[model samples]
Target chain A: MPEVSFVESLRMTLREEMQKDPLVMLIGEDIGRYGGIFGVTKGLLEEFGPYRVRNTPISESAIIGSALGAAMTGIRTIAEIMYIDFTTCAMDQIVNQVAKIRYMSGGKMKIPLVIRTQCGGGRGNAAQHSQSLEALFFHIPGLKVVMPSTPYDARGLLKASIHDDNPVIFIEHKLLYATKGYVPEEEYIIPLGQAEIKKKGREVTIITFSYMVWKTLRAAQQLEKEGVDVEVVDLRTLYPLDLETILQSVRKTNRALIVHEGCRRNGIGAEIACRIQEEAFDYLDAPVERVAAMDVPIPYSEPLEKAVIPDEEDIIQGVKRVLSRN
Target chain B: MKEDHQIWLELYRMMVKIRRFETLTGELFAAGKIPGFIHLSIGQEASSVGVCSTLRPEDYITTTHRGHGHVIAKGGDVKRMFAELMGRSTGYCKGKGGSMHIADFSLGILGANGVVAGGFPIIVGAGLSIKLRGTDQVAVCFFGDGASNRGPFHEALNMASIWKLPILFVCENNQFASTTSFHYSTSVKSVAQRSIAYGIPGRSVDGNDILEVREAALEAVERARKGEGPTLIENRTYRLRGHFEGDPQRYRTKEEVENFLEKDPIKRFQEFLKNEKILNEEMDRQIWQAIDSELTDAIRFAEKSPYPQPMEALRDLYAEDVDPLFQRSLA
Candidate 1:
C-alpha cells in the first residue's frame, strides 16, 4: 500500500476509469491545460489529450447542461463546477434537467453523469468559493451524493460513481485535498451508501462526513484520554445515507451526535438526527445533538471564518454534552 | 436555382401538415381535451419544416416550448404526440411529460424544453458527442428571439465555435418574448447579428419563405457535417397566435395580428407551389383532406388510449433499483 493525497487519488482514479472506458470523458473550465483549479486533474489533459479532457468556457449552465446532454447521448461525462457555490448559476440545469430527466422521460433516457465540485472552507477563500451544499443536492431525488473524507475512500467511491447509471454529485472538500491517506495499489471500489468506522467506541456515536469526519475523529482521540469512548462514523455517501450503520451505532452507544460543516438549520445533520430518533427511539439515552456551522455567510478573515465553522473543540463539546445525559 | 418539383411538393405537404395539426391542437385545447397550456407555432411552420427537411434521421435536434412544428418536421409520430398532449400511457413520456416535454430519442429528437434557451447548451453537448463518436451527424437547436439573450446561448455559441463542434442554431425571431416585442427586449436589431460576436457565420432570412429558409438551412447543415463548426441563422417570422392558450391579446393590437397572419408561411408556400405550377386547387384540396384524415386518426388514438396507472408515478424515477424504502412504499 502506498500513501497518496486526496487529489492525487482522484487523478489516478480518473486516469484509470478513462483508460478502462472510452465513453468516460471530462469537461470543465481550466481543467485541460490548467489541470483544474484544485489540481485534481493535473496531468489528465496531457495523458488523455484534449479530446477526452475538454476545457469549456466560463459557462456553468453550459458546462452542466452540455454534460447532461452528452450523458443522455451515451457518453459518461464528468463535469466540474469550479466551486459548489457556483452551482447556483446552473441550478435549473441541475435541479430541473439533470435531476428529473430520467423520471420525466419515464426511464427512457439514462444520464450517466458526475458533477465534480469542491466544497468547504478553511483556507480563507471566503463565502463564494467555500460552501458545503450537499444538503441542496441530497434533497433532490434521482441524484446520488458522495462526499469522501479520505484519499482511499475518494478513489474508491469516485470509481464507483463513474460506473453508476444515474447522475452523481461528487463533492470534494478543498481542505482535504492535500491530506494524505493510505490507498491500495490494487483496483477496488467502495460501494456508495456504506459507512466506515474511523474509530470505534461505545460511550458515544459521532456521525459525520467530509472534512468534519476528520475533526470528529481527532476529537474522539482526545476524548479517549478523558476516559470517554466515542465511535466516529464517516458517511461517505450522503444521499442514500447508510442509516443502518447509524442506527446500529446509536442503538449500541445509546447516544448520537451529528456534526457537519453546513449550517444547522435544515442541514443534512437535521435529517440524520430525525431518522436516528425515529428508528432508534427506544435505544437513545439522550436527544441527538448537532454541531454545525453558524448560520452566516463565511467571513473573509481567517479568525472570523474559523470562528464560524465547527472545529475539533466544537465536536468535543458536542460529544460531552450528549454523553452527559448518561 | 431551379428547384426539384418533388422536394418542393414534399415541403409543401409537410408545411400543410404542421399548419393543420396546430390548428386542430388549438381547437382541442379550447375544448378542454388537452390538460396543460400549449404554445403553438402556427405561423412559424416554414422555418421548422424547411430546416428539419435538410437534416438526416441520425442527426439530433432540441426544440423550444413552441416546438410542435419542429417535432412534426423531424418525423415524430402524430399519434404519440397527441397522446402525449392528452396525458395518455402511449405518449412518448408515458404521460409524465406533456406537450412541452415530448421526446423521441429513436428519431433523434433530444427533447422539447419548457425553459427558454435551455436547448442551446444541450445542443452543444450533442455536437460534442457527435465529434467524439467520429460521426458526421449535425445537431440543430431551435430557439426563439427571447432565448438569444440568455447566458446559455452565449456560452454554447462560444464553446461550439472554439471546439469546432457540429451544430446549427436556428433562431426563430418571431418578434415577441411573450408580450414584449424583440425590438423592445433585445438590444441588437437582429438575432443573427449577435452570432458575429462569437466568430461564427450568421445570416438572416425571410422565415415565411420556405424556399429561402430551406436554402439557408442546407448551407448551415452542410458546414456542420463537414466539421466547419456552427452557424446561426435568424429566421425572421411572426407568432400568429397568442403566446399561449388563453393569452389575452391586450399586449398587441388586433391590427398587428392581422398583418402577421397575412404572411402565414403555409399560405405563402401554397402560393409559391402554385406559381411554380406544381400545385393547383385540386392538389391543394387533396393535401388538406389527407392531413385532416391523419389528424382525425391521431385524435382518436389519443382519446382511446388509457391514462397511466397511478402507481406508475413512482416508477421510472431511477434506472437502478431505488432504495428499498421507496420500493416498499410504492409496492
Candidate 2:
C-alpha cells in the first residue's frame, strides 16, 4: 500500500476502469484538455485521447443528459457536475429523467452512468456550493448515492460504481481531495452501502459520513486520551445505508451520536437517528444525539459558516452529550 | 420508378403502424391503462417517418413528448413501448418510464423527453460522440416550435454549430406549446430563421408533405455525414387535437385545426404516391393491413403484461455493478 492523496486514488480508479473498458469515458466541464477543475482528471485526456476524455459545455443539463444518452447506448459515462451546488441547474435531467429511466422502462433500459461531483462546506463556497444534498438524492429510489471518506474507500467504491449496471451518484467533499491515506496499488472495489468502522471503541458510537467522518475520527482520538473510548463509523454510501453495521455498532456501545454536514431537519443524520430508534432501541442507553449543520442555509462568512456546519468541537460535544445521558 | 414505389410503400407501412399505435394509446389512456401523459403523434406521422427514414440504425434520434411516431419510424419495439406506457415489468424501462419517456437505443431512438427542449443538448452530445469517434452516425433532435424558445435549444445549436457536430436540429413546428401558439411565444416568424445566428444551413419544409420533409432530411443527413456540421430544419406542422386530452382549445380557432386535419399526412403521402404512378392502391392497402395487424399484436402483448412487481421496484434503480450501497447488504 502507498500513501496517495484522495484525488490520486480517484484518478487511479478512473484510469484503471477506462483502460479495462473502452466503453468507459469521462464527460464533464473542464475534464478534457484542461483536466478537471480540481485536476482529478489531469493527464487522463492525453492518456485516453480526446474522444474518451470529453469536455462538455457549461450546461449541467447537457452533461447529465449526454451521459444518460451514452449510458443507454452501452457506454459507461463518468460525468462530472463541477460542483454539487450547480446540480440545481440540471435537476430535471437528474431527477425526472436519469433517476426514472430504469424503473419507468420496466428495467428494459438502465443508465449505467456515474455522476461525479464535489460537495460539502469548506472552500468558502458559500451557500450554494457548500451544501450536502445526499438526502435529496437518497429520497430518489432509483439512484445510488456514494460518499467516501478515505483515499482507499474513494478509489475502491468509485471503481465499483463505474462497473455497476445502474446509475450511481459519487459525491466527493471539496476539502478531502488533498488528504492522504493508504491505498493499495492495483484494482480494488469497496462495495457501496457498507459502513467502514474507522476505529473501534465502547463508550459511544459516532456515526458520520463524508468530511464529517474525518472530523469524527479526530474527536474519537481526543476522547481516547480522555479515557472515553469512542467508536467512529463512516457511512461511505448514504442511500442504501448499512443499517446492520450501524445498529451493530450502536449495540456494542449502547450510546450513539449521528453526525452529517447537511441541515439537521430531514438530514442524513436524522434518518440514521430514526432508524436507530426503530431497530436499535433496546441497545441505546441514551437518546441518539445528532451533530449536524443548523437548519439555516450555509452562509459565506467564516464564523457564520463554522457556526452552521459540523466541526470537531461539535462532534466532541455530541459525544459528551451521548455519554452524559448515561 | 420501381425504387420510388418501394420507398413509398415502406413509408405507407410506417404511417399505418404509427397511426394504429397512437390510436390504441389514446384508447388505453382513456381506460386508465397507460400511466403519465401520452402526447399522441397522430398528425405528425410524416415528419417523424421522413426524418428517421434518412438515417441508419446507428444514426441517432432524440424525441419530444410526441415521440411514439419517431420511435416506430426508427424501428423501436412497439410492444415494449406499450408495455412501458402500461408500467409493466416487461416494458423497456421495467415500468419506471411511462408514456412520456419511452426509449429504445438499439433502434437509435433516444428516450422521449418530458421537459421542453430537453433532448436538444443531448443530441449535440451524441453528435459530438459520433464525430469525435469518427463514426458516420449523425444525431437528430426532434422538438416542437415551442422548444425553440428554450435555453437548451439555443445553447445546443450554438455549440453544435461552433464545434461542427454532426447533428440535425429538426424543429417540428406543431404551432403550439400546449395551448400557446408558436406565433405567440416565438419572436421569429419561422423557427428555422434562428439557424442564421448559428451560421448553419436552415430550411423550412411543409411537415404534412412527406416528400418535401424526406428531401430536407436527406440533405441534412448527407451534410452531417459529410462532416459539414449540424443543420437546423423547421418542419411546419399542426396539432389536430388539443395539447393534452382534456385541454379546451380556447386559444386557437377550430377552423384552423379542421383545416390542418384536411391535409392528413398519410392521405397526402398516399395521394403523392398515386400521382407519381409509382405504387398502386392494392399495394398500399396490403402494407396498411400488415401494420394494423402488428399494432393489434403489440396492444395484446401490452395488455397481457404484468405490472412491475413491488419487490423489484428497487432493482435497476442504480447500475447493478457500480452501486456500492445496495451491494453492502450482501457483504
Candidate 3:
C-alpha cells in the first residue's frame, strides 16, 4: 500500500484503464500539453498520444456530444467539462442526448462514457465556478452520479466508472485533489451506489458525501468531546443512493442529520431526509434535519463565501439540533 | 452527375419511397392512427436520398426531427419505422422513441435527434471514432437551416475542423425552423457560408435537384473518406408541409406553399429521369405502385405488432447488467 494524493489516484487509474482497454480515451479543454485544469490528466496525453488523449476546443456541447457519439460506436470516452457550472452549456447533450440515447435506441446503443468534472466552493471562485450542481444530474434518470470522498474511493470508483457500460457523471471536488490517503498497490473496485460508514457512533447519524464527508467526520470528532456520539455515512454514489445503508444507520442511531455542500433547497439533503422519514419514520428519535449551504450564490469574499457554504460547525449544530429534539 | 441509368433510377425510386412514405405518415397522423406529432421531410427527399446514396451501410448518419427521409434513404426498414411510430415493441426504439427519435445502429444510423442541433456533436464524435479506429468510414449529419443557428452547430463545426474529423455537415435549408423562417432567424444569407470560419470547403446546391445534391455529396464523402476533413453543404430546399402534422401553419401564406409545391423534388427527379429515357410513364407508375404496396404492408405490420408492456418503460434506461441496486431503485 502507498499513500497517494487524490489527483494521483485518478491519474493512475485513468492510465491503467487506458492501458488495459485500448478503447478508453480522454478529451476536454486544456487536457493535453497544458494538462487538465486540476492536473488530474497531466501526463495522460504524453503517454496515450494525441489521438487517444485529445485536446478539444472550448466547446462543451461538442465535447459531450462527440463523446456520446464515439461511445455509441466502440470508444469509451472520458469527457471533461472544466467546471460543473459550465455543464449548463452542454445541458441538452447531457440531460437529453447522453441520458436518453440508450433508452431511446431501445438498448441498441451502448454508451461507455464518463463525464469528469470538478465542483465545490472554499476557493472563492465565485458564483459561476463554485456552486455544487450534482443535483441537476442526480435528477436525470439515465445518468449515474459518483462523488468519492478520498483518493482510495476516487481510484476504485473511477476505474469502475471507466468500464461501466452506461454513462457516469464522475464529479470531483476541487478541494479534495490535494488530500492524501492510502491506496492499495493492487487494483480494487468500489461498486457505485454503495455507502461507507466512515465512523461508528450511537446517538446520531450524519449522512453526507464528497468533500462534506471530511467535514462531517471532523464534526463527529468535535461532538465526541462533549459526550455526543455521531455516526458518519459517506454516500459514494448519489443516484442509486444506498438508502438501505442509510436506513440501517438511522435505525441504530434513532436520529438522522443530512449534511451536504449543495444548497438546502431541493438539495441532496432534501431527498435523503424525505427517504429516511418515508422508510425509517418509526425508528426516529427526532425529525431528519438538514445542514447545507444557504440558497444563495457563492460570493467571492472569504467570509461571505464561508457564510454561504456549510462547514464543520454547521454539521455539529445540525446534529445537536436533532439530538436536542425530545 | 455521371451515374449510370440504373443508379439514377434507383435514386429516383428511393426519392419516391421517401415521398410516399412521408405522405402515408402524414395520412396516418391525420387519421389519428399515430400517437405523437411527426415532422415530415416530404419536399427534402433529394437531400436525404442523394447524400445517403453516396455512403456505405457502415458509414454513419445523424439526422434532425424531420428525419424519416434520411432513415428510409439510409436503409432503415419501413416496417420497423412505422412500428416505432405506432408505438410497437418491434420498432427501432421498441416504442421508447416515437416519431422524433428513431435509430438503427446496425446500419450506423445514430438516432434522429429531437433537439435542433443535437446531431451535430454526435456526428463529430462518429467522425472522431472513425479516425481513432483507423477506419475510412464517414459520418454525415443532416440538419436544417434552423439547426445551424444553435450552439452545438458552432461547437461541432469548430471541433471537427481542428481535428480534421471525417464528417459532412449537410444543412437541409428547409427555410423554416418550425414556424420561424430562416429569413427572419438566420443571420447569414447561406448556411454554408458559416463553414468558412471553420476552414472547411463548403457549398450550397439546388436541394430539389437529385443530381446536384448527389454530385455535391459524392465529393464531400470522397473528401471525408480520404481523411481530408469535413465539408459543409447547404441544400437549399423548403418544407412544403407544416413543421409537424396538425400544426396550424399560420406563419406562411397558402401562395408561398403552392409556389414551392411546383418545385417538388420527386417530381423534378421524375422529369429528369424521363428526359434521360431512364423512366417512362409505365416505369414511373410501376415505381409508385411498388412503393404503395410496400408502405401498405409496412402499415399493416405496424398495426399488427404488439404494443410494449407499460412495465417495459423501466427497462433499457441502462444496460440490463447494471448494479441490481440501481435496477431496484428504478422500480
The TM-scores, one per candidate, come to: 0.97, 0.93, 0.98
Interface RMSD of 3: 1.3
Query: What does the lDDT read for residue A86 in candidate 3?
Result: 89
**Considering DockQ, which of the candidate structures 1 and 2 is the better prediction for this target?**
1
Best by DockQ: 3
CA lDDT, every model vs. true structure: 0.91, 0.84, 0.92
Q: Per-residue CA lDDT of candidate 3, range A38-103, in tens?
A: 898998888989989989988999999999999999999999999999899999999999999988
What's the CA RMSD of model 1 in angstroms?
Answer: 1.7
- Between candidates 1 and 3, the DockQ winner: 3
TM accuracy, model 3 = 0.98
Per-residue lDDT of model 1, residues A46-75, tens digit only: 998887898988899999999988998989
DockQ for every prediction shown: 0.69, 0.42, 0.80
Candidate 1: lDDT of A264?
Answer: 86
lDDT of 3 by residue, B31-142 (tens): 9989878999989999999999999999999988999999999999999999999999999999999988899888989989999899999998898888889999999999
